[model samples]
Target chain A: MVDGSARISQDPEPRKNNRVHPVLKLLYKKRWAYYFIAPATILFCIFTVIPVIRSFILAFQEFRLMGNVWVGLENFKYVLTDPVFHRAMRNTAFYTVVMVPQGVLKALILASILRNLPEAVQTFFRGAYYLPGVASAVVISMVWKWIYDPNFGLFNFILGTFGFGPYPWLTSPKTSLTSIMLMGILTAPGYYIILYLAAMKKIPRELYEVADIDGATPFAKWWNVTLPLLKPTTLYITITSIIGSFQIFTSAYVMTQGGPGYSTMTVVYLIYNTAFRDFEFGLASAQAIVLAAIIVFISVYNFRVFSTDVQY
Target chain B: MRRACWVLVLVLLIGSLAVSFGSIGAASKWTGTIQVWDFPRPAAAEEWELQAFKEFEELHPGVKIEYTKLTWAGGNEKLDVSVAAGQPPDICGSGLRLPYILQGALEPIDDFLTAEDLKDFHEETLNAVKLNGKYWAWPWYNTLYVMYLNADLFNERGVPLPENGEWTWDEFLSAMQKLTFDRDGDGKIDVYGFGFTFQPTYLQPFGFIYAEGGRVLDIDKNEFILDSPEAVVGIQRLCDMVWKHKCALPGAGGLTTTDVNNAFLNTRSIAAFVDTTGIISSFEAHNEKVEKGEIEGEKINLVTAQYPRGKNGQPIAAGPGVGSWAVFKQKDDAKREVVMELAKFITRGEGQKEVVPLIGVFPSCKSAGNVWAGNKNLEHIVPAVEYAVYPPMHPNWNKIDEKIMRELQLAVLNEKTIDAALKEAKRQIERLLEY
Candidate 1:
């Protein structure tokens, strides 16, 4: 460390001669950097770090009408073996698996298609597709609820035109989860399309022009140039989509209510039920920690797979 | 730059000082302002709430009330968040479950009520809000499950009107079969005989387990008694209504409150199974729909009766659900006294009389029942109240209800045998009781 500092001091121009003390000089040079970082650092510690530590401590304590009691890992043991917890895990896993690939593929295709359109038309289409992402989940879920109505829904009306019998979209245990997943896939691809489109726009036109001169078709250009350039955005979207899908509560809470008999009872919904509905906060917190761990593991795995040997 | 920095520091210091003093100022006054949290109900109830507030301000000259409405579906979570933030409302409406008390978010009101105060309220209503020998709330209203019938359908089919509130399994099945009809001769049966919901609220009939000489829990021992032979038989009979008898409409377990209510209102179903609150408005609003001329050569009437008796011959209504107001143990003695006074004023006979007619909510005071009966519009609810039973006061009641309701649904859906489902549910409830 001393040799590195001495070599910097031995520069030909003698630029360091006016420095009173090395430590003071270092502080003065990076003062603006410290100022720029202060707000986010304070906020992150107060909100994110503090709550996580507090929730961990709360997981071991039994909260009841009288007071809290320290009860070691009893809460963890109970949550792991609880039937509702098991069902929630299964449902959340199914949703994550279904939503991630479906969301990414559709967003990719839309982004590639939007790339070829004129700028004005492209902006209009992008905004149109992105509208669902901007709309509140509560509003969208309520509207979709009416659309899934068995007797009077637009879906059944359309099916009737083809002479199909009425389908109970949100009522049947068999179809409820798939019906919700279809809605998620449709509504969530908008933001990912915007991300991928932005990344596609940043790629130099020269690469695509060379591909065209070299007799590359549209499919080949998308496969070789567009997809490779969009790798970083794809990784970001994949991780976020998996995390978002695992935390799905609003749809199930509003529409199916974890039912047609627990078919849509996701992990976060069970945590909510255990904590608020049943007042089992200790168990709820333990389940939440497990859920958070699962999300982190899955996200890390996705990042490793998509981040290997990739550059913009 | 130095001047701007001084200005930023000055602003933040002043903000902190204001915050510190503002809380102290708030702590010193009754301020005549109270915050209330309530869920939106039907338009009539909303109107009644506004009127009640208007009357309250006139009676208590300086008090000002602000009301915030929450959605029924998310009210509990909203209340939880408020409590966690330590800013719970001065007054709130809650369901009988009252999750806050169980979770340690509520303050007991025992010290606020005197012995004389306790004597005036009905024992059953008081018992509903009491936990561990301390009263947590003032009981507001009550609801129970009752069987509503389409009397005109009974007359057309020549079936008896379910006398004595008792029917054997075969008799109930035969009556439903007679009520089913395909009026237009289409392949489809346009009108179902009986419509029932499979939600947790409807599982009240499972209370027949007790009526049939069975126990849900050995109260003294805290052991689950759901696997007892009598209890199994009672549950099996409920599932048999859907699976074995085919008396109820298909997909009945999946039907929601809206679905069943619409079926009855549209006259698509003859005999409807619903709570007393469910049919009151329909019977009042569309009396003409069931009138003689509306259905050429057919007449319709509305009647309600207790649920049918099991083999034991005793008809039991599952416990009535109750709602109540709880006074928080305020840190300030004067504020606490005022809150207690507010609770007493809302629950007194005069208050009950003022609100009962507009809201149709049952009175918690026994004498208030007379007020209920005197209203010609509310007279029908009296008989239902006569048979009301409060559910067991266990903190785990909601969890147990969820498990049993799921088992009942599985049996109704034919996904599992009745015995198997009952056995699993029994095991689950036993585990919960241990906790």
Candidate 2:
């Protein structure tokens, strides 16, 4: 943080008889930067910032077209007491508890395997894994629905050929939540894999060479050198994966539709149903605010747990 | 001076009379663009859908109707959002007792329509439109969900058809067991006897529930009664078909309407299912294609039947929903009147005649009387509309429908007991109606 005066300009003196005001000079210096940022800034404020602010206000009111009545804490109280909301919270928490670790591990393993491959092979594999991510979540969910179908799905077909019994992957309430989380864990977290691979490249070769000279095997070297160095990247992936798992919706919506009971319901999906399906916008806003608060608290806790000081 | 005063008095008298006539003219004359939204489904909004707009423009010259199209997926939500933003279309089909009516976003049809005008529509449609002793929308069309059987499949399995398309639960189950058989020597079953979807407001499957004399809401529309013993028996029968009998498709509760429809028609795996009149229309359309060698599929000998009866002697099904046009509340009295006229013109005989062929729905108005005289597919299905039970009128009914349908799915999946499922649904619905 620079002081206010230092931020204006590094130059202390102006040209003799310069007509421009100090403020105008400062503004003119950053004119192109302002011009470049204005469109994005304005649009961000209009679409994202304004809606978020309005939703926050809406969280405190009974939303009505004619007149929105101030009913402070009422919607929050309703959400707290609602059994469905409690179920959704439990589902979301369970999904995160299971999904976050598996997602990070999947990405880490894939990235590690790809890191040692030939450049051409690695590129092809990366693209292959990322291909599914390129398609919309709705489309992927539809494909997964076919794959999980008990009667005619690919998974059941394979199992049937071996004379193993068919199990309902998404239909039964017992497996619906697990099925949803498995989708998240299996959907190729390509973005995180790329991040890990990039971070792995930055790890110093000297550390691995030292481990090798100390009679360490490849796996031991990886554990001592590669693993410890990727802490920052792992933390990034973990926090993001946790957030994504909590917000899992499209797969659940397109597949089980939060059903076979409330087994597959997530907080975000429930919020959507409460607002759009039930037309309880105030309650929905309140639920969303609560979710945001939860995310912030979790993110802070994650930072405290995962922060690292390894600079090399 | 006297001549000058007389001249001024004559001018003043003429001016006052002119002003009074002008006010009357302004009150009667309506102009400007009436923002109209089309039916949500694009397929439903064929060329003939614009007939009402053209007619309105022809009758009231200089008045423009700005038409907008909405998709079925989020159309109602769009209308609700528009209303909240104070820019709802002048006319739309927001249903009779939905949020638009509950929130006072639409005008009551009774205000603009006379008793004589109401006479053209069937009493069933009118019943659907009436909410709180006031009609909320113009009755446009009627729908009756019926159980459709693949008669060819029945014949192949040597299963006897129900007597007069009416059968008790035992008879239906026995027939279903015969129809469900493995074609190949493989141990796995090849064809299932039944399939149905459990989507929100998808009421076709609920026909079976009503057969057990199970009702969702009371007359006052305030409580959930779906957890009754009869209702439990009703849902249990469907569940038994899946697990105990194994005569139904696995994971049927998660199947879509399209999935079941395709299985009944194209895939030809499932022998039977319950669906709206549109399925019969679709069957006819597909058979036409098959005849022309346009597509290849199994022969479709569509058989329409009442939902199988349970403890209740008579068959019961859900229907009697009047898909109706409604006018949004307008500040200008003249504009509102014109909008009402447009709504009426769009829903009456000529408009019904023009769109029914494209949409394949039975018209609610008697004046559009028997548009299905030559259309054999829909003609036979019309009589079943009499056996229809209207869905309960309530604002939270959509959410309640979802809760009940989810419970139905859970029961069918054998994830929960039928009693537990319906009770959970009841608990959820009671929570929705807590206010």
Best-matching candidate per TM-score: 2
Q: After TM-score superposition, what is the CA distance of residue B353 in candidate 1 from its true location, in Å?
A: 6.5
Interface RMSD of each: 4.1, 2.0
Candidate 2 chain B lowest-lDDT run of ten? B376-385
Q: Give the residue spans of candidate 2 off by over 4 A.
A: A1-28, B1-35, B40-49, B52-78, B94-97, B112-120, B160-171, B280-299, B309-315, B332-338, B349-355, B366-368
- Candidate 2 lDDT, A1-312, residue by residue in tens: 889668557757755646678888888899999999999999999999999999999999987765588999999998899887898999999888988888799999999999999999988988888788799999988888878877777888999999986888887888877877777766888888888889999988888888878999988878878898899888888888778877888988888778777788889999999887777789999999999899889988998877855443
Task: Summarize candidate 1's per-residue lDDT along B251-306 as a digit string, tens digits.
Answer: 65555656666666664464646565545665665666546456432333666656
Q: Between which residue pairs do clashes occur in model 2?
A: none
**CAPRI quality level assigned to candidate 2 from its DockQ score:** acceptable
TM-score of 2: 0.86
